[model samples]
Target chain A: MTAVPDPTAELPVAIAARPAPGLGALFLTCLKIGLLSFGGGLSGWLYQEFVARNRWISDEDFASSLAISQMLPGANVVNLVICMGDELRGLAGSVACVLGFLVGPFFAVIALSALFDSLPDVTMLEAASNGVAYAALGLLLVICLKGVQRATKFPPGLVVIAAVAIAVGLLKLPLIPLVLVIAPVSVALAWRRS
Target chain B: MRDDDLVTLIAVFVPFSLLSIGGGSAIIAGIQHESVAVHGWISSREFIDLFAISRAAPGPGTMLATLIGWKVAGWWGALAASLALFLPSSLLCYGVIKVSNAHKAKRWHKAMREGLAPVGVGLVIAGVISIFRLSGGGLVAAAIAVASAAILTWMPRFPTLGILVLGAATTSALYSLGD
Candidate 1:
């Protein structure tokens, strides 16, 4: 008779092999997220849909993926496609996710542009549009606050750098010069810590 | 849309897509340079109006390409230009992510993130400063920024859409009354 097997080693494989949602389902879900997200809620909405509502990845995994994406050199949404793709289906999965992400937003923007000329220039509509802009600013501010909170938990040196960068770079000095100074300092600090 | 216009559309969008970092707003100066200054696609006033529409509508601010495209060459131009604008960034992002994941635990990956933190902060700060400059140092503009920031922090419950609408309405009304 065979000895009883341990369950721990089987867990990751099981999670990995767990059947993915159907392609149609995945596409629809992504499209829905793309369509409904408004006034800068896309990132948070994505987090909710992918991590909270769906169980494709663990919370820690999702957070790390998000952080990595933010660090990368593209729009956060596209970066998300890469993260989700890797987690779900490797290279092929990444392509599919990226395609889905791009197609929906592209078509939606086209549709909106088509309607641009016909959109009423009335007072109420104008008012509503203005309101949306301010709301967008507020949404962006909230996102920045979250970023700050996350950064604060890192080394105190980082917090100091961020503060100085904001006060001196944002308020006083020009951008190009400020970046030239801060970039080297930040790199040096990271090198020392490492 | 003329074929030549399609070529111009691609020319404008390809570089813009590559350089439009931080967010869509960060690329506004570039857009202004292209549309208002270089190609003369639209007047400055019209550019401002388009900017308003892009922000007012839902979805990414990069969607401004569609409207500008539409203005340049009609529906087909809009479609072609929008695709060109987004495709490069999306493809580049996908490739980067793929490679990064392959060696995620490496020191270079960690260093990249550590290095980027300051850069990201700098870019955002630059964007905020740029917007401040565009507000022309007017008291009303300064008040709007401060008040908006305060309200957002203190009453986080209020929907952002609502705030934007109120500000726009107040501005429009004031403008209408010859302020």
Candidate 2:
């Protein structure tokens, strides 16, 4: 599984049609991003590697993938990887990218679990972790604000943000029902505006 | 790991994955309900700790599944839980992307994207509030969060890990001094 994708083999016409990078290169790049990124800035790491450094995808393509990722479910970073992988190298590439991205953290979290078990008395470690968690909230708040700015081009977009915050955040309604109710309304409004 | 436990992991996470519509934040309450109350895999306090650790760890915040599974049933459980939560949603996404690509310029696609953008933002804000509450909503925690947000807004290029380390060191020093 760790073998490099053959650079010279006759790739299937489907894969050959796209300006695809080797699966090995895609996996390694994902692995590097996974291992190096910390404290919840995975997207920033992804943007740097895929868009800025390597130019594997253009800025617009990255933004579009990010939009799709956000619009769908699960983790935005994971979805983003899936979209990038699909675009670059199809289904196998998508699987490889996800595995590459997740493998490091999978092992790291297991190691952390072991460490937590051993350091039962490390009150300071707990405190530091709390600090980091709270700080990550700060990062999240900025991202939310930026997202709001992006969404507000249409007038009803602000309304959707407020309604969702109230319904899901304050009212504590469960999300699936809330989304089922609000999503259609927001989409209709967007359709009208369009 | 017990076979029953593996089955339970699958049953709990698969539905949660489908419900994770906006992102990981959307399903936090559901996961908490299942893991802490319904299944009794971990205590509520332990749930919070795992949440914090998962948040602070690299990779997706959804790795909380891996941690929860690891805690409950070792490596096999971790494997089962992560796949259950991740696989279905990803496959759905792949399918949707394929369909959406065919209709790339359709008005409905635009509407869907526009409609969901704000909801995605709202979910993230809710996440911030939840984390703030989890951190005990202390004046120091609030101050750190607000200050960090302000600084990051001012300097969009600031290194996030640097800010994380700064927050940790500053809080740790305060606790040491208090003690």
Candidate 3:
């Protein structure tokens, strides 16, 4: 019989894979992710941290984890934190991850709320925000395109679904009705093909 | 507010946390149902406005929990609502991670990923469409979306805050001109 490839041997020797991060480091990383994650780059950042930077997980595993996070309830990023924490350090890690992720945003929101009075009247601030919104839309589009490229092996069906969905949405069709119509048809096609 | 009111607020948000499948936007319907239809905490117009603010805010859209909580029950309420919205799902996710690690490379895990990807794409597209709709159908809004998409594709190095500020300024300037 041919020798089976050793998975462990394939691991990068240059990158020392430590055990899960300590509570403080975990908290700090999560906080940084939270603060820096403007307009939702949280998933990409998580992939970089856990998979590319830390080498704690593989890309396939990260993709799968992200999938599960999206499927589950709560914010996808928060779910991912729990997933990563549990994988690394069990229960306490999970708690720490959640706390770390939420703390920065929570305080930031509270602080911003206090500044409600001046928010609308501040023209420069409004101008800055408008710029941010435009950039956010760009970031969001890139993320979506990347996601589409990754997920779709069958380009034809994928393009069709994307185009149809975009059309319906732009036409001002109600979301619920569109979902009800497209979801089942897509599932049926997938089922039949499988 | 009374203790019962606090409990009711928590009850509304807790289930919402669980049912929010896609993210903050996914829970909008549920939030509207509970806050407007059932409890009468906020009117439809107010709910819609709150959604706009949440989307425009610099942080997670779920920060609406804090806003609604503050409206309903002051500081304590805000804290409670935020926790309730986040904790259950966070714990559930932790549980999922534990189970997934134990069952890595299993067929079900792979299958679940395959199934979720399309659904997620659909959901996200739907969300974008809905946001566009909410911005109101106009050449200006369409131009904004198209121009934003093109600029982002070309020069992603541009800060997001800068883009949003520009959009708001353009809109405000146009509005002023119309007056």
Number of the top DockQ candidate:
2
Model 3 interface CAPRI class: acceptable
- Judged by whole-model lDDT over C-alpha atoms, candidate 2 comes out at 0.75
TM-score of each: 0.64, 0.72, 0.67
Regions of model 1 farther than 4 Å from truth = A1-26, A51-76, A83-88, A104-107, A110-116, A119-121, A133-153, A157-161, A164-169, A172-194, B36-45, B107-179
lDDT of 3: 0.64
B1-179: candidate 2 lDDT, tens digit per residue: 79999999989999988878767877888899999999899999999988877765778888899889887889999999899989998998898788876786888877776666666666666656665665684888888778777776665456666667777887898889989
lDDT of 3 by residue, B1-179 (tens): 67877788788899989888757778878888888888898899877766655654545789788777877888788888898898888777766667766766775545544444554554455555565555453566656656665654454444444554556666667666765
Please compute the TM-score of chain B alone for each predicted structure, in the order given.
Answer: 0.65, 0.68, 0.72
Q: Rank the candidates by TM-score, best first.
A: 2, 3, 1
TM-score of model number 1: 0.64
Candidate 3 C-alpha lDDT tens digits along A89-147? 77887788778888877776666666753467765554445444443454445445545
**What is the per-residue lDDT of model 1 for residues A1-194, given as tens digits with 9 covering 90 to 100?**
78555443223311343366665556666666566555444554454456434557543344445544544445656676667776677767776666665566666665655566577755656544443343344444443454454456556435644654466546665444455565566556666667
**Ten-residue stretch with the least lDDT total in model 2 chain A:** A8-17
Q: Per-residue lDDT tens digits of candidate 2, residues A85-183?
A: 887888888988998999888887777767776875878976786676666667666656666665656668778878877776777787667777787
True interface contacts reproduced by each model, as a fraction?
0.25, 0.61, 0.36
Which rank order by lDDT, best down to worst? 2, 3, 1
Q: How does model 3 score by TM-score?
A: 0.67
Model 1, residue B133: distance off in Å is: 10
Candidate 2 chain B, poorest ten consecutive residues by summed lDDT: B152-161
